[model samples]
Target chain A: MAPLLEARSLCKAFGAVTAADNISVAVAEREVVGIIGANGAGKTTFVNMVTGYLKPDTGSISYQGRDITRLGPRATARTGICRSFQIPQTFARFTVLDNMLVALNVARKRDLFFWRPAHDAELDAVAQGLLAGLGISGHRDQIAGTLPQGVRKILDIAMAMVSAPKVILLDEPTSGISTDEKHAAMDTVMNALGERGVTILFVEHDMEIVERYAGRVIAFYDGRILADGAPAQVLSDADVRRYVVGGELHRRQPRKGVA
Target chain B: MSVLTDRNVLVLLAAIPLLIAAGPIMPDWVRFFLQVSLASGLAVLGVVVQMRAGLVSFGQGLYYCLGAYAAGMTGHFVGVTDVFALLGLGIVVAAGVAVVLGFLMSRYREIFFAMLSLALSMILYGLLVKAEVLGSTDGFNLPKATFLGLAPTEQALRFAVYALTCAVTLLAAIFLYRYLKSPMGRIGEAIAQNEIRVEYLGSSARTVVHITYVLAAALSGAGGALAALANGHVDPEMANWTTSGQFVFVALLSGTGNVAAPLIGNFLLEMIRVYAVAWSPYTWQLILGATMLLVILFLPGGLWSLVERRKAGG
Candidate 1:
């Protein structure tokens, strides 16, 4: 089967600084791929180029056999690719349910002028279902901005899932959440996507969380992939050790034996 | 049936008949008050559209003046005094100008958009002030509008026109309330919140904003035409920056949550100005400025939010 998303030699730059340089990766259907990188390692920039938020200065992106390299962000989303931000970008004043509903509307191809009560009821059911799947049903009526960071992150993931995307990109999905809450949030996100058979490519800084969830891991440094393989092999690679793993993986090596 | 059931809108619908009835029983000043309130309500609704989308437009007066001038010119040069035709001409002219300006204005964001719109409107104001055919600074006197060839010279006719204005304004308000609850309106809110995110979601922020700008301009033009019809005159000051500021002030005072807020603000402002001038003619500006400052300081979300908070508390 064709890869769900394929990027060939993707290259992007910001003036003198290259943000994504000669990167080629493919995410298979139902696969969970993690990108681990340090600060300013071009992870977010790579995701931006793939999602059409930024144009790659070189190379091409194809989703399920369609060349979508030059397509706008909205077109990419319509073609079954969606993304969540590092900091959840939600309608702050809107309720969690309303935010989900808006996303559903974006996914819809129906005429908006029709004001049938039945249509609204169907949308409500779908939004509630997604929120429940993300374990955020209890906060459905709560204003999104007022929610805790972990819950807000879940809501952001839930919004992205409204379209039932083929490939979902999460930019530091566990960022700014408490340690105890981070695992729970990741479990919810992974489980929801797994149930939908959705492929995910997420950027994460937490090594354990990345190891626990990622079936395949790719290490990025200075706008290029430094390593790619199973979590154990990639995390243990010498280049990844020096550039990305640093001394942290060495500290965790004894803990791996404990587990 | 849904329209009739809405309590907030029901009051405005009911006010039209009540105002018309009072014209026969009450003084001429009361009838004039009703007419001014109706016109001001329409203008305020125009402002609500911009404010709700998190835009501060200083160019609404451009459309308002265009509508008024269009009506006046059509009556003077084209000899069309039919109310419906005059209003239609005003809408077409205003919509045309909005489409052209929106193309440029929608490309700009935040303070840049506001300043560009202000500059464009000011240029139009200057052009109108200098045009000899448009009566220059002396302004144009509009012919009395006849309703389907029936010209009534009685006080009842003025009341009838005012009642018509109220009906049109209420219909527009109701339509706007429903429109804002639609998907397109939600997209506008999304654009205001995170424009880039909205774009990534398969929607163009520029398209959404441009549509909104044009719609608001068309409505403001409708309001301006009604004002000119009621007063039987159009002036360059109708589209002045200060006039645009007054619309924004009323909108900010009203808030975006309720359609009635702007109408209420307009009525209150007009009544307060009337009373203030009666007491001391030159002090109306001071009173208006002070009242606006207080509203901005105490009720930042506008009067509608205050009403919502009070109801929630109760």
Candidate 2:
């Protein structure tokens, strides 16, 4: 079967820096993949290019077997490819439920012109259900800006999920979350997506998370994919260990009981 | 509780009859000033619409002048004095201008957007000042507006225009209330908050901004046409920078959260300006400035916040 999303020979550079260079990736439907890389290693660039936030210098991106390389972020999102930001991007002054409602409106392609209200019983019920599923219903009425970072992160993900995209690129889903709360945040997010049978490619620096949640791993180094395979195989690859995961392995190895 | 909130319909319905009745008991000057306030309020409401999308259009007077000029020209050139026809033509003309300019204006944001709008309005002001055929700076008077086919006497005309203004203003408020509650309107607020997130939600921020710019221009144009009809004059001053600034001031004075805020704020501002000029004509500007400062400091959400707070509390 064709992959849910595919990138072919993607290359992008910023002046002297190559943000993504000759990197290719495919995300299959219902697959949970983790991407690991150091800062400036092109992990984000790859995701950006795929989600149409940034255009690649060369190569093509296809979603559901259709070319989407030139599409803008909005167009790409409409094609069932959505993304959450590294920093939570939400309507800060609005309540959490309002944010979800806006997402649902765009997702459903509702009529925006004329006298229809933004809220209804059906929309409220759906928003509340999504919030409850993510364990953040308590914060639904609160202003999104005032929520704790972990809750904000979860809310951002939940807003993206409201569209039920075929593939979602989450940029550091647990970055701002407290270390203790990181795993719980991921558990809520992964379980929610899993229940929907949605494919996800999430970037993370936390090796433990990659090991625990990711069935497939893609290690990036110097704008190239160093290794791509099952978590155990890719984590032990010599080049990945030397270039990307070297120092962090010793600290995280004991937690995962990996040799 | 309908798809569009209808709670404010009763308030709107009540305001119309009360305003219509006030025309007889109110002094002539008071009634006249109220008509002007309602007309100007429509323009301020336009500014508020753009503000919801995080845009501050410093050139909204362009449309205001366009509306007035359009109405004025219809009476002077086309010799059509029917108030509704004049207003309709004005709206169509302003919307046409917006369609062309919105394409360019929508690409900008922040200071660039504000300045570009200002530049466009100033351009119109300069052109109006130079156009000898259009009465230039001195401007020409408008013929007494007719209602359908009846041309009332001067006293009756004032009451006619006043009643019409009240009806139009009430209808605009109701229409705007529905729009503010609409999904499109909420998305505009979302654009103001986080445009990037709006894109990821599968809606183009630029498209939303463009639509808002055109909608606002239409409203401003209609307001300008009404003002022209009420004042019985059309002048280049209608499109001046100071006029645009006043519209902005009114938008700030009234929070964008509620559709009626700008209308109420504009009326209050007119009353305050009248009293200030009467009480201390030389320092009226100082009084206006002071009031603005106090409102900003104490009511960051403008006068509407008071209403919101009361509703929340009660």
Residue lDDT tens for model 2, B1-314: 66233568878878999999989999988888889989888888889989988999888999999999999999988899998899999899999999999999999998999999999999999999999998899888898789899998888887888898888878887887788778898998899898998988999788888888988998899899999999999999988999999999889888888888898898888889899999998999999889989999999999999999999999
Highest-lDDT candidate = 2
Model 1, CA-based lDDT: 0.83
Write down the DockQ of candidate 1. Answer: 0.48
Candidate 2: where is the Cα deviation over 4 Å? A253-259, B3-5
**lDDT tens digits by residue: candidate 1, A27-123:** 8998999999899989999899888889999999999999999988888988999999999988888898888877878778431442321127789
In the order shown, the candidates' Cα RMSDs to the true structure are: 2.4, 2.2
Predicted model 1 interface RMSD: 3.4
Candidate 1 backbone clash number = 1
TM-score against native, each model? 0.95, 0.96
> lDDT value for candidate 2?
0.90
Clashing pairs in 2: none
User: How far is B73's C-alpha from truth in model 2 (Å)?
Assistant: 0.5
| Each model's DockQ score | 0.48, 0.77
Question: Chain A only: TM-score of every candidate?
Answer: 0.94, 0.96
Q: After aligning candidate 1 to the native by TM-score, how far in Å is the CA of B285 from where it should be? A: 2.0
